[model samples]
Target: MSQRPTQRCHDYVQEVFAQEDEILRTVRQQTAAHGMPQISLEPNEAKLLQLLVRLCSAERVIEVGALAGYSGICIARALPERGRLITIELSSLHADVARAHFKLAGLADKVTVRQGAGMEVLPTLAADGPYDLMFIDADKGNYANYLDWAAENLRLGGAVVADNAFWGGSIFNPQTDDDQAMVAFNRKLAAHPQFDSTIIEVGDGIALGVKTK
Candidate 1:
């Protein structure tokens, strides 16, 4: 028998720090059944997102990628009754799956699934205003562009949380376009003067930036 240390640690984290219920399990199954990519955040990362939402008192949230409503549901569950979450997806099929999951999770009212390229759709959301938190998990090539929008749209003290920041450890020596884009995104966030940021060593990696001015 082969024992994998990382797998063991992952199981331990799931057991002790990030337990998922039936709803989350069903969401995972649905996404897989629909042929969506298996790239949702880990259980611990999902819990961390919930905590961050609470920590920031986020009432208006935007998610750049809604693969199968897993992250959307995770963040929506953290909201107060009146809070709203707008999630954008590039694939209409994925959007449909996410909407169904949101309905099953009884978050249909709280979550709005928009199907379109994020850059094109984001501009239409400008009037939604000064969001409390923005979570970017879309195409890596556009991560920095998303940050640009967040910087302009999020209110002072609002947060921008980006997933897949490490690009599967490619930040050190990026070989592909996506990996190179992530490296650029990381550097841009770390050096930007208007926002205070840090990269959390979670799942892949999560870059968190708070607008200061």
Candidate 2:
């Protein structure tokens, strides 16, 4: 595989989707079908989501945000036959759009969406124990809290992926009070004994954590 998706990879993604399974094709069309923000996963991000899900053979997954259902669709599509995905979305509007996309993707059954504050829902939902994978892409101020919860709730050998951790190349500067919260969370995630961490500068930013027992 190409180390990082550049022009060639972009072309490859188009090619991959040229013959994409009908579900993904429908998803792509639906995402393009609506005038949603470009919050959907980029090619590299989508590839990584797919890879992470396949690697874990994730039976259960949780997403902290469901912006248009772009990332959720990619992640959920990778699950096993018995797998399930629960996405927490803050907006009823986004949730409505995402529900339509999920239905179009033929994943309406496998994907469950809850609209509310993620923090309130997290404590209740995470108690079920050991979600195989979780993605954090919600408000930046809550990054640390989410990581703390994910550490406690995610299964051993599972993974937690955070997007926009870099905040559009802003982390390199002296951490500002505004973005410092996100930076602080990154340090906490790195130092935490339970996880093996890596930071990669993909779109915005992505941090991957492999949970250790």
Question: Which candidate wins on lDDT?
Answer: 1
Q: Clash pairs of candidate 1? A: none
TM, every model: 0.95, 0.86
Top-TM-score structure, candidate number:
1
lDDT of 1 by residue, 1-213 (tens): 896458778778889989989999999988889888988988988988989999899999999999999999999999999999999999999999999999999999999999999999999999979899999999999999999999999999999999998888998988999989999999999998879999997788889999998
Model 1 residue runs over 4 Å out of place are: 1-10
Q: Which stretches in model 2 have alpha-carbon errors above 4 Å? A: 1-35, 174-178
In Å, residue 162's CA in model 1 sits off its true spot by 0.6
- How far is 176's C-alpha from truth in model 2 (Å)? 5.4
Per-residue lDDT, model 2, residue 35, is 62
